[model samples]
Target: MRPVQRPRRSRRVLLSAAAGAAAVTVAVLAPQQAGALATAAVPVAVVDYDSHDATEYAARWVNPYGPLDGVVPQVDPSGAVTLSDVPFKPGTDFSVFDHLKYIGISTQTFTVPKVGTVTFEVDIAASTPGATPGHVVEGVYGPPGAWSLADPDARPYTATVLEGQQAGVVLNMIDFCTGQLFDWFVAGGSAFPLIERLPTSVTGNTSNPGCPGATEVGLDKAYTQIIKNIPLEPGQTHHVAISFSRSAGQSNVAYALDGQVVATVTNVGIPLDQQGNRYAWTGTYPSLGKGEKLADQINSLSIGHGLFSLLDAFPFQYGCSPPTTSPGAGACSPDSAAYSVSLSPAERSFGQGAEGVFSGFRVTTTGR
Candidate 1:
């Protein structure tokens, strides 16, 4: 006689939801194996309102058994924390500091027990929408030497969740001069070659502030999702994940639509040695003039390993604003809506690892 199989509850719910929405749905059947597959399932962490900083819209959520460290700020020369600087209204928005530098929050310390794909997601918003062009929410992965902002390896790539335009953006709950949003970035190491970028757009809202010349909402209310394939070692692979939404979460607005997929990358290979350590970095560039610093606003970051991991959420200052076609029209102003995440053991860890946690997620909005 043949054995009976049980259906997955979550799968059933997903199917029902798809059917109710009148969306095309496809189902695939998996072949039964003699023993349970030793594949590792990526864990998930969700942060609604409670997990973030009410003031800055930032937080750090952790997974116990996962390999993830804390985030930090990129130091400046004046002994003050640095931020990315772009062009914008004085009290209305923030800015990005430099173009090529890596400025945002990071996820350090991750371990892969098997070879598979790693995915990440987060909800993000901005204060002033549709004001600039050079803004972006990017993700970086792989060893320090293996990654690059200018020319990232084919494995670790970037996606533009939102494209900078002159209209249609959304904001967060707080009514400060600025608001907050969710953004995510993903990269596949040498092992996995799948990459993607997801950004949110202005949906169900019709409000325009900040730039009178702009048309779309001044902010976005949505999430950024990332998926990457990674090759693990024979036993385990130590890896890291990081998220950085620069320019007060206002860059790349063209791609900012509700539940839109911005970029996708695939075809990653296997790693030669996976049983090592992993590290990540996130922060802002600190060398620009006073009016060109962006407030780095990071909400929450997570690292998972076999269902155990760590989270850190905090508020730091970088800068913001929309991209400008004019030479000096939309420069970044200091509005204090940015945050940072700092980690220890600057490099990847090979053995047992530890992480720090910072909790706080909030954003202040100005203007009408």
Candidate 2:
């Protein structure tokens, strides 16, 4: 399949098109600046899901379930995509997954410049009254390794690479049981800040979704010391941005909430496609024509609402499936998994289903 390229647009024009009705709020989650990496105002591509059919912007909406199951998200006339169904359900039998349904949209995958920075940003708002909180909304950008569109069982491109594994980078807002938002980042197998404790109202309650009696999940310290808590309320819109920068002997990715820098991962390598091709930026997947073999970098990226490894691992990693801490302590435990993948009953309740809006999405690039 050939690459689909959209005419370049300035940040001002792109933002205006996706402004919609609600005003976008920018909050600072960390003290460090995003630096000059993403300072460019012109974008390589601007996908206004609010103004155009999301399909027209990229390749496909790939998922295991169909619209009848409500796993397929709807892009309303207002130009926002709404996820309103329970995609996956794991019964009392914790040993196996009973039902697994997921959905996500992607743009035609594009390679990144060798010496430039690539930024992917989106605006999200909780929509469900009681279901939105305790759920996470994700924004992802990175190299897609070993993912193929031709494979009938191909997982979502956003499926995170396990720890001790190298693929790409990921950033998401964890609006866990407390109904508050927290920043989460993982590159390959390494996750930032080690551990992040939600607000007292969340941790204080033993019955909270993913919070059990234990204080340690993966790390040794609390993430609050470096990141701030943002309320995850219905109808409130927040902007999330992640930038990947590469230069001589240095490669790092920075995450920003609203408009402030929150966390940055350093010493990262250049993101490569499955074909061993080096690309700096990837937004969506382009439609693949017959017989095309270029690495399909497709993912449910434009809005990451998918369940494969992400949902499967969320419980054991954070929920402490068997509530064990020692590495490989229990069968299918967080410690045993390379990437954090724990989902408690309460966490599963939230993950079982959710509703939210993605008002806008864009990707910008700047060369050093």
Candidate 3:
């Protein structure tokens, strides 16, 4: 996506439109320092995505029998899912059957009051099951990366923001299974010299001690630090913050009440080890139009040790329609009924600010 163009600030004074109105009232104002308030404090909205509260947000899909079955027993209106199952044994796999058909469980959209950075606070807790000896579990989805609950060897997870129209720093929280802490300050999409990864500790500390448990990942070119990583104990709560801000190269993007920053990447210019480079790519796919070829967007933020991959499936927003027999048939066609969300000026403003910030909005499914 292209960077957002910032409007030029002018110093010329103009008369107020309501100045001459008879009903208008005036109040005294105090003078402030020049550079003191140079940076505006933008208002940010925090939406919690938990599964326990059903009325808060709407669910796109609900299944009591899937990979998340007894684990994530509840979902809230803010799109938060909570897992309370305990005694999570290592190497044990459970499934919430029939729920795999849907991608997102709950979703919310918010509007940006001003142009600034946006942050997300995600609360994750390991159940009493996870605290047991030999019990282990890993997050299958959410942000990016495969994090093990028991194994201390899994790689950290990565988070990134699509600033303006382009993706920004991809912050990776390296080896993060040890602590119950939160990370902070991931640069928004505007910063360049992109960040690929960042290293973090299980103790919720960003300081590097040069140990085997230290988590390492790739980032484009931004600074970030692990803030929190609360483990699941009996009645324990873990909170994490993924903050986003404007970098040097571009203007800031506005956010809606429902949007949030789930992850971030920190930049470490040098390679982590001598065996090979810190980052690598498998192959490139050609960009194609609707009828040409299908090219997937790059998932700059990812966790674990594997090449990024995209899944080919029916666009959920467009819903399933009658099957087609022609090449590139089915709902994949441009004229299919599967594309429900419009990118027009009116509909696109759901998560934008008056300053013309374009932080891109996501459409979530609601389970009736």
How do the predictions measure up, each by TM-score? 0.23, 0.43, 0.28
TM-score order of candidates, best first?
2, 3, 1
- Candidate 2 lDDT over 240-259, as tens digits, reads 56554544444444566555
Worst 10 residues of 3 by lDDT: 21-30
Q: Tell me the tens digit of each residue's lDDT in model 3 across 189-296.
A: 121112212212112323445233433321211122221221212222222223222222221111111122222222222211211443331111111111110011
Candidate 2: stretches off by over 4 Å: 1-51, 54-58, 64-69, 86-101, 105-107, 128-229, 232-234, 269-347, 350-352
> Residue 239 in candidate 2 has what lDDT?
59
User: Per-residue error at 217 for model 1, in Å?
Assistant: 40
Output the number of the TM-score-best candidate.
2
Q: Which 10 consecutive residues of model 2 have the lowest summed lDDT? A: 20-29
Q: Which candidate would rank higher by lDDT, 1 or 2?
A: 2
> Could you arrange the candidates by lDDT from highest to lowest?
2, 3, 1
